[model samples]
Target: MVREVLTVSERAPWWRAPAAVTAGALPCLAFPAPALWWFAYVALVPWILLLRSAPRGRRAALEGWLGGAGFVFAVHHWLLPSLHVFLFAVAALVGLLWIPWALLVRELLGGTPGPGRAAAALVLVPAGWLLSELARSWQGLGGPWGLLGASQWQVAPALRLASVGGVWLVGLLVVAVNCALVLLITAPAARSAALAGVTGCAVLTGAVWLWAPRPEPVGSLRVALVQPGLVPDSPDSPERRFDLGERLTGTLAGQRPDLVVWGESSVGADLAARPDLTRRLAELSARVGAPLLVNVDARGADRPGIRKSAVLVGPGGPTGERYDKMRLVPFGEYVPARALLGWATSVGKAAEENRVPGSAPVLMDLPGRPGVRLGPLVCFESAFPDMSRHLARGGAALLVDQSATSTFQDSWAPAQHASLSALRAAETGRPVVHATLTGISEVRGPSGGRIGPALSTAASTARVYEVPLARGTTLYVRFGDWPAGAALAALAVYCAAAGARAVRLRRPGPEPSAPPARTVRGSAGRRAR
Candidate 1:
């Protein structure tokens, strides 16, 4: 009997590990701060090429894990001040989600694949990458902050694509382009196919731009944004912040603004607990001649724990409509699995106690406006596409995100947080108001076009924006994550096919038939004859 033996290769060079990490981190530049939006198209080329060159599946997976960790750390390095060394631990764990993706890349792009395999790589590789993103986007993991598609927030063409299929489609196309570029670089026989893939992406985007349903301009609203800028850190800082917001909002008198917005935690105490604060807010609303949408970061009066809420205060005071924050920041609002990872608080500024999450989304009706409705999302919740999509489906004419990134004022976090609103706006085909406590406040129209100059972190003032209101539902809002569903389906089909092939390879061949009896009887039969 003959048997085949598989050879195990030696370990990969030590330097390749760091190379993979560096390549993974390159995509961060395409995000905020540097915001080289065009860089996103080819940012994954080096990483893909490196993974493809891996000698073994295990090596490819290891490099994939390292690259994922690097990407996560690079994108979220701003949290170092709050998460400290614990951030590395998070990067490592969340990085595991990319292992399968890495293996898939290796299998598809390893060596110089033929035209057929190259075509498959363009489709399957991007699907694998999207699946990894979908997995890490869970609230317990990190949510979707640096999604590759998000880097294109400023691109009109990309924004048009987002309006049709949401960010998931944008990310898929971005990754597919990267894969095609990698193939063009390494696989000469497949260059034509790769070019076709790139062309296909462009054609799809252009088609959406030309044919996608656009939001119709219904009217315009005068919205005032109050940004208090930086308040000195002190024991009474919350009170000081509140006072600053109140003063800034008061300046809007006779502005005839339809709505006045304060940044996250603009009101330090719950209005239910502090009647004076409620009355003061109402007075400011009356003075401004508009309804006030202020965020409260305080212990809940009805609930037991701390709750961050967006409360609407009219001239009459405390409009019963309120939307508590549903999604909480992992370490910022509460540490995940505190019983097991409670020590995180000792290492960094992790939350001491978890804040209670809101039950569901709420759409508040605009004061005196019969049809207009406002959908409010708290700081971390703004990063979630589904949350905004849900609100848009619920008949929200405007999307508002109240955010505070004071801890990361000096880092890329503020800029990144602000950019997400543009994508959300484009996806939902509704104007988005991103009001922040410390800075980087911005507004985007339904097409994801900037409405006005963003308020810098250095500016402490109130600004009025003539925000255009739009009507009609975006295709993304109606279809609901179809891109993700398609990616998942593609991956499932690939996995099933791969599993069947592996089974076929491992299945034993038909057993060797016993030699004729003449073999055993040859000597004896000769003697007998």
Candidate 2:
């Protein structure tokens, strides 16, 4: 019977692996482009079921890795144009983070789990998932894009939860609910435990929503976003792009915007080298009756390498307030470990020269307002929750992300990029202004609600937004990454307990040595008789 069971379990079915891969891709639908936010709650069911049914630990690990690769590739499919086949390689490498998570799931839910194991599964599986997310969130692996919690950007209750524990907490709850649902579907005996887990998550979310401190309504700001849209590709495309942005800013002359914002790479030349361009921006700022926050993508005269900077141009040539971009897009900005990966440039749109990183986050005060401090993030930096949280902690009234996604304008990348602002705003309890060169320009209130309609990629125009400013410290900002810390602690305790149990089971027992001596004594007594 044991041999028969082992053979049956070890027999590999080819379709099982592919099923897991397809199951993993289902979660991407919850993100933008499809925008099926509610789907996130059950999206992991099929994947979890597949993992739980794996015949052996080794096969389970393989399924986990393949599923992770599928998920990463699906969510970031828009990067195909820029990264080409290299995207697959990247996804496969990052997918390895899920191996341990898969093993944990099989251990807890594979067999007919009793109520105790089922209850533990509800917590441990989610914590394991979070650990995978935490691992892949490192900048080199790929920043926190397509986080499971980010799918709920438009959900009000989810946003409230974000205020209490950041995206980590939201993700943990989401995965926990998925685990419960999986148990409810596959483990009939564990249905009571599953229901209890679901109830716990609901109660916890409700408590946070009712008790968490809300940002006080302080005031509002009138901000104008200048989107030049697409300029035809040409040798003089940079010059033409600048001209178009200038023309658009000129149209806002009588609008009386408190501040005018432009997207990343709006300025092509170094301000110090080209005084004429500086003067042109200054004149535009004067005409608009506000300081212009434009991005400069040029070789700096004072700096060593090509730098993308957020420069503040007042009525004067320059306000001397500038923020260099701190985070660079892995392949888009520079290939990682160029000595080993330099071949990436030849195959795709990877940057030939690496851009320099900024020394620190900068909070620039809007010229005329005493308390209106702006935290500027360039392009890829917006994807990181910590960057915005840190800036908000430093007293930034508003978080602004200047981005140019012209390369991915037609793809889901723009919409996915735009959606991150909502999460950031909700996490920090601050309004966010996402200004892009091509389109998808949007503003979110401090509560993560959209202030107005978003500009589509095809639109070439400027729009004004009434951005509501708030004043308060969010729990996430005050107590950073507590959810991740808690998850780590839970995993540690489980491992330690499991280790002790294994040690106890393997310990040696007392020897059975008395039988032999008795037999020999009996034989000697019989011979004497």
Candidate 3:
């Protein structure tokens, strides 16, 4: 009866792991809000406790599943309308992913983890998270927005981690910290536990406060971001959209900005293909006395309709530099496994495969500044930590993401998604200039925070920004994702070895059931033969 009661309580719906994880994730949005940024660390505690108490295997798996569903579902509830059906499908599929994460947390907390067990247990959570992020962001599953670490864009110290290891590492560390806290709570009073868990976190918080990337002096390039009133679907109305690039440039021309930026897909077709439009943009750049860093959509003329692309244009001519986006939002850009899954691809009449991916990261030369390279990330690419890291690796002075969030016009998706870029800047210690097609175009210093004005696509407006182009590179940019990937691989190997040993130990040992009845039988025989 006691066992039954315990089992029932474990499986009960109320206050389950799902609720804990959900609660933990929901409060993290406070990360982007200045007064509430500290909530991120506090938010993790409950989930950590829940992980500590979970049983193994199926129950642990289910607990984690619920936790994952709650976390993602709560954070991404805004995406339901744009990706409702897809969200449901993806939610169901990702349950498999969460189970192990829950189980891993349980294993790590048990204190039985050796190097192999520790690695195995540790790798599962982050690996699962990265894979899920990758899968969801892909076109077939749904699209990438609001990944967990992205919430910390407004927090300075947390953002620093992104530039170093990418957002995956940030997510990994957050999970690790939560696990550590759980360990700290369960252990008997030990000096090291308090020092490592409580004091370590305190010291780390201080490090975050002081370790911000130094900003470069704004020697020359004062820039402007234009927010057009026209929506994405209605962008075809040129009188409404065409005048934006020109008007914004002309308005900011007096400020003598060396460059002007419009939002992503702001130019419907490739400017190079449209000679008349190119001339008009050149005129705008000339009038502004700066090169225009324009975000172009449509098939590339040079690549012959091979990919969706972005390019640079100036009074002198096109900069001969362009960046094609590598990572694409799955359903938003291209259908997933289309050849195999196209039969079911149409959900609510939203046919997939709207865009193709670019092969490499493109760093454009800012006009008048030969060494100042613009790291270009168009819309979805901004979600990929490695994309920016790749550009930063190749001597990018500034990171620029051109985005169009017109699809989720009514939701807070623009603001939520845009916040992530700030963390990316912090991670790489490079400034990020995020210009959007509809709304929330803004600037972020190396550490994730709003440094300049963000254009509101809700109105026709423009803001000229003097962005500090930092000259130094970060360790994260130089190293890339190799460290984390290596760690994950090592973890996998360790887990495999331990699992093999467990299986061997469990293998039926030498046959037993030795002769046990001889003494009693001998006494009976002596008395009653």
Candidate 4:
């Protein structure tokens, strides 16, 4: 019997680790505050280039993980105010999820130099990235906050693409463009394929704008977004918040808006339990001559626990229609496995009590406006496509999000949170009012264009927006995330094929025959040749 020995190489140097991290962080510039949305096109170029030097999949994945850590930390740095130094650790951990993405990228782009590989890299890399984004956006983890597609919130072409295929599609195109750029830089022979890829994307964008469903204004609403603002060190009193909201509402009385919208948790007590508060809101509604939609975050009046609800208050008082927030922000609203993470409140922004999630999206019928319905999403729920899509499908004439990024007022979070509404509006083909507690409030038309100047976080005031209502559903609302789904499926098939090929390459072939030895075969025989 013979034994075969295989020697494995040592790991790559430690310096490459930081290089990966730096590459990852570069993409953060593509987001808000210093939002260079165009930077996203080349942001990941360095990371892909770095992978070209990796000797194996493990090294590629390690570098990828480091880069992801950098990106995540930079993007979510605002969490430091609440999460403290622990935010870096969370970012690094989340970055580890990109290990597989690194391996996939290296396999498709690193080793070989061929047009076929370049083509595969273009499709698979983006698909893999979308998958990673999908994983992080799961309800248990952080919701989809820094999605690459989101960086294009202000881009008209991207908005049109989002309307056709949701943000996921936009992200796919972005990643595909990144991959094409990588191929363009690394493989000169594949330049034509890369150019073709770029041209195809341009064509797709044009097609979406030309052929995609365009939302037409069916009616309009005079809506007022009341931002009461917030002050740090303020007592944890919902009454104070409610009072502030009332004052803001009073200022809007002369405007006589069709609807009065307040930010999330503007009223802390459940209106059902507090008749006095309910009546006060109803009176405000009567005074304003419009239905007042107040967000109540408190212990459920009829149920056992807390609920974040949007209760409609007509001049007559609490209308039967109410919408509870379906999507709850992880750790913010409720921690996963409360028994273990319940202590988070002592250190960070985690809420003490978990707010119950609502069952279904409710399309609220406007009090006096017939044939018009308001789709309400609470806070982080606006980041989700399905919630708004369902409402749009149910015939919502407009969309409204009650959000408060007050705690992160100075951070990029407020800006990022506010930007999600534009995508949602475009995707659903309905005007969206992103009414918030502390500034960055914006109104986006059905086509995802800014309606008017955004309410800055620097002031507490009431601004009435002429929100143009669009009646109809976008293809994204009708077909859902079909592009992302197709990308996922295609990537799965590609990975399976690659995996089988790797197995074939690793399988051992027939061993060479041993030379004959006469002395071993016959003791007395001469040495055999």
What is the Cα-based lDDT of residue 259 in candidate 3?
68
lDDT of 2: 0.91
Quantify all predictions' global Cα lDDT against the true fold: 0.91, 0.91, 0.65, 0.85
Model 2, residue 437: C-alpha shift (Å): 0.4
Candidate 2 residues 336-398, lDDT tens each?
Answer: 899999999988899999988889999999999898999999988998989999999999999
Off by over 4 Å in 2: 1-10, 513-529
User: Which prediction has the highest TM-score against the true structure?
Assistant: 2
The TM-score of predicted model 4 comes to 0.92
Candidate 3's TM-score reads 0.81
Q: Summarize candidate 4's per-residue lDDT along 247-270 as a digit string, tens digits.
A: 889887778699989999888888
Clashing pairs in 4: none
TM-score per prediction, in order, is 0.95, 0.96, 0.81, 0.92
lDDT-superior candidate, 1 or 3? 1
Which stretches of model 1 miss by more than 4 angstroms?
1-10, 512-529
lDDT of 3 by residue, 76-137 (tens): 56667756676655565654555655665676655444444343334454565555555555
Comparing 3 with 4 on TM-score, the higher-scoring candidate is 4
